[model samples]
Structures are given as structure tokens and as C-alpha cells.
Target: METKIFAKDQLDEAVDLLAKGELVAFPTETVYGLGAIATNEKSVKGVYAAKGRPSDNPLIVTVSDEEMIARYAKEVPERAKKLIKHFWPGPLTILLFVKPGSLPTAVTGGLDTVAFRCPDDQLTHDLIAKLGYPIVGPSANTSTKPSPTTAQHVYHDLKGKIAGIIDGGPTRVGLESTIVDLSVKTPIVLRPGEITPEEISQVLGEKVLINTGKVSDKEVPKAPGMKYRHYAPSAPVVVVDHVEDFAHIPLNAETGVMALKSELSKIDLPEENKFNLGNDLVDADHNLFGGLRYFDDKKQIKQIYVQGFDEGEESLAYMNRLNKAAAGHHFK
Candidate 1:
């Protein structure tokens, strides 16, 4: 199957289809999003079918500007405003309380809060702007499958499953956005991305609470990627907790290690049993899916082992994607 790469103006047609309740796949700074009108139930439902996602999982609404955000959310908090000024048109997603008549329940999974982001990519922004409505923008792939960072990745996973795909070039972040919930009095980091928690705190002058990684009944998540198994590949992938345990990886001609920056010297695996993405967390995060695709393309590699990151803002989102990509797979 061939993927269609659409120009910015061509995206208007996809937006037209979305207004008529059709699904379209497009790129964002974080990752490619499979979009449909958020208020239209059929459009939202079509997104779920296209990606095989569960109904209970909510989708983030992508808008073109701050004004559009106000149209959906009841109140965008003061701290949220500061963060938006710094991170808007980037990969930061702010979760705010949903207004009474703003959007359909389908977009929020019946929750009173909606996850929203104004994408930095012009092509994606134009699609939402042309539609003149918030669109349900979730990573364009099957639930738990690797999120598409490039248009070809979308076609690789969702070809013939969705109506059309806008093949923008590679995503800048190559991971999902940092999801911050502003509905509460204090800003909390539900999920971290390229925008570190330190950066968020610097802007707000208040320490942002990081989710304890424990699922509690009181927690009302605003986005689909949180506390969920996501971005997994077909083969088993494991994350190593200790560099010393690198040797414990089930090594052979078929096993491969995706190592970290400082720990590369610690890895003594055979050339064929190793693939170096980069040592830096930023590089590792960006090259994650691409490396997975590389290994997946290598027929001899049957299992993949990854080196886990120490806790930090940059590490948080990287770990999130890595953990999920290796979910139901392994730990070491």
C-alpha cells in the first residue's frame, strides 16, 4: 500500500471529509495524529475503529490557537497560560475542565476534562483550522502499537484502515507531548514529554506534582496515553534497570540491545546483537520508534532489550514510551 503525502493546502480536503464524518491521519510535532471532528460521534467512532482503540480511552483535541482552546475548555488556568505562552505550538498538552456545551462526551470519554494541544506543525494546524472545530487527535496507530512519527509509519500501521493520511515529514519530538492537568488548583504533570517538569516549574513558580505511577480511583486522567499500555511492537522488548544486567539480556544472534548514552561502554554484546540509537536521552527518545522499526525489519532479531532512564523530565516521557513499547513484553 502507498501512503499519500498531502501538501498544507491539500489538508483542507481532509478537513472537509472530517466535517462530513471521515477519518484523516496527519502529523503533529509530537507524532502523527489520526484526526476526526471531536464533536461528531460518528467521526470519533471512526477514529477508534481505524486504530482499534477502546472507547473508554479519551482523545486529545487539537486546535490552531489559544482562542480555540477557550472555546472547548471552561477556564484555562493562570499557570496554564504561562506554560502555553512558552510551549504552545509545541508538544505540551494542557488538560482543562470541559465547558458545559463545548464538546461531545465521546471526546472526553464521559469525563468533564478535555486534553488539548495546539500543534506547531503548519500542515496539521491548517487541517484543524480549516475544519473550524476541534479534532480528536490521537497517535495514528493501533492501541499499544508504536506511535507513528512519520507519515510512512502511519501508512505502515494504518494503511487501508483509515480514509487518508497526510504524509508530513518526521515529527520533531518523536514522542507524545507532556500532558499537564490544570483543572486542579495546582498544575500536575500527568505525563512528561520534551518539556521537562523543571521547565514547567520554572514557569509556574510552584512545584508540579508528578503522578506516582500508581493507578488510583480518584485520578481522572485527561489523555489516552496515561496509565495505559501503549506503543508496543509485535516482538517482545525489555528495559534493563541496571547497566550491569546488560549481560543478563537473553543474548544470542537473534537478541539485540538498545543501549543508553553513558552505558554504551558497559554493553559488550556482539555487533549483530546491538543497535546504537544514541547515548543521550533526547536522541534515544527521538530515535525510539525508528530503531524499533529498524530491528523489526531485521528478520534475525527476535527480542529487544533497552536501558532504562533515571527519573527526570526528559527521562519521564522517554521512559513512558519505552516502558509501553516494551509492555506485556519484559523487565530486567
Candidate 2:
């Protein structure tokens, strides 16, 4: 299929394709999501086929309003309502009990629960609002590659595989939404993103647990990033834990590196091989995926060296993605 790129005002084209049960990628506050009507079984399956995503890994139902979520979810608990009131139109995905037969097995991965997110993008909201239904919004990239932050990135990995793309420019938050599984008695974060567990806890007025460990090979992940080799490029990646560690790392024109401006200034690698992770952690979080994709475009890059941050509240989300992208390879 010829993948068409739609502008903000051209959402009617995207809605038309989605209405016909086609997979069209759309923008979100987080990353570009490969959208299919959450209720359309065939179209939702097409998303897995196009991304080569595992069938067991479920998708997030992206909606514009609370009413849409209510339609599919069995019930939104009082605590969940609080979270939705506080963080809706933002990067927070909550897992809830699914109303029987409300969504397709393809969307729930045959699980009893569903993940729902309302992104903080007017264009995305408008698309869903116009369509009058929610869409499954998984990162618009290949199964294990970096999540697409820009429409061009979506086209690069998914051209001809998907129907079209709604180009809402680059995503504001480079990482995916924070996924909190509230289907259980105790809430646990399945995936970390811009909204940290601490932030979630603050709003809920209770402690929230975070799942930092990897899911076992036998287990099916509740969220996308939990059991996948995600945000990785073709080249091998190594995480450098300290600024001084870069001195020990062997670098060359073909070796790609990512760090803060101060850190990049200290290195002697080729300008083309070096990607600035920005001035601080916030910038690092925003630039992490883009930096990986940048190195991916360079055919000569054999290995990538990235600056690592200590695992903490502010740094958790960034480190989580970097660690996965690097596959726990740290520069010793």
C-alpha cells in the first residue's frame, strides 16, 4: 500500500482510512503510534502483521475522552478516576478490567484487561474525536527498533506496510507513556515514561509500585516494553556510566557516541559520529531515541557508546530505555 503522509488539517484522510479498518499511524504526546480501530479485529491484527509485533504483546487503546474508555473498560475505579482527572491528556496509560467482548482479542492479547491512554496532543485528540472511537496506539516503528518520534521516522520503517501517517511533527516526549497496571489490588507500573512512579503516587495519595525487573521468557508482558528488545539499532550499544569512562572507550569515525554537550565536548570522536544528548537529564530523555535513530542512519557505525545516568526517580525512565537499548552492556 502507498503510505500517505497527512498534515494536521488533513486528518479527515486519516480518519477515512481508519474508518475503513486500515492501519494508519498517528501522533501522540509520547511517540508516534501505529493506530488501528481498537474495535476492528481485522485492522487491529493488521497492526501486528505490519509491525511484525508479537501477538501476545497487547496494544494501548488511545482515546480522546473518558467516555470512550468507559465504553470498553468494565469499570474505572475511584482511584483510577482520580488519576484520569489529574493526568488525562498526558503520558499516562492505565490498565483496567475489560468489559467482556467490548474490544477484540487482538487488542487485549486475549488478556482480561486493557490499557488505555489519552495523549496530550490536540491533533491526536481531534483524529480520535472525529473517528468517534479509540485506536490502538503502539509506537509506530518496527517490532524492536526505536519508536518513531517524527512522521518521517514512521515512513522510514513502515512505508508500504501501513496505510498513512498523520504528521504532527516530532513528538514532545520521546519515550512512550508510563503504563500503570491497576487491574490488580495493588497498582504497579508496567512501563516507565515521562510520568514517574513518584509522580503517579503523588496524585493518588498512596504508594505505587514499579516493575524494574524483566519479564520471564515464558510470560507474556502486560505492556509493550516489558518483554521486548526495544529502541535498539543495528549496531551494538555500550552504556558509559561516567564522564571519565569515555576516555577508556575506544572511539573512531565509525564509532557512534551520545552524551551531553559537556560530555560530547570532552570526546574526540568524529562530529558525525557524535550525537548530543542535550544539556541535562530532561534533554537526555528527549534525545535518547533520536540519538539512536541518528546513529542508525549512518551505515558506517559499527558500535554506539552512550552516556548512562544513575537509576533514580528523575533518571529512571531515561535509564530504563537506555539500558534496554544497550541490552545491559555497560562500559566497565
Best by lDDT: 2
Superposition TM-score, candidate 1 onto the true structure: 0.90
lDDT of 1 by residue, 43-142 (tens): 8888888888877778899889999988778888787789889888898889889998778777888899988898888887777777888888999987
Q: RMSD in angstroms, all models?
A: 2.7, 0.9
Residue 228, model 1: lDDT of: 67
Mark the 10 consecutive residues where model 1 has the least summed lDDT.
212-221
Q: Please give the CA lDDT of all the candidate structures.
A: 0.80, 0.91
Residue 294 CA displacement from its true place in model 2, Å: 0.7
Q: Can you give the TM-score per candidate against the true fold?
A: 0.90, 0.98
Q: Cα lDDT of model 2 overall?
A: 0.91
Give the alpha carbon lDDT tens digit for every residue of 70-161 in model 2: 89999999989999999998999999999999999999988899999999999999999999999999999998998889999999999999
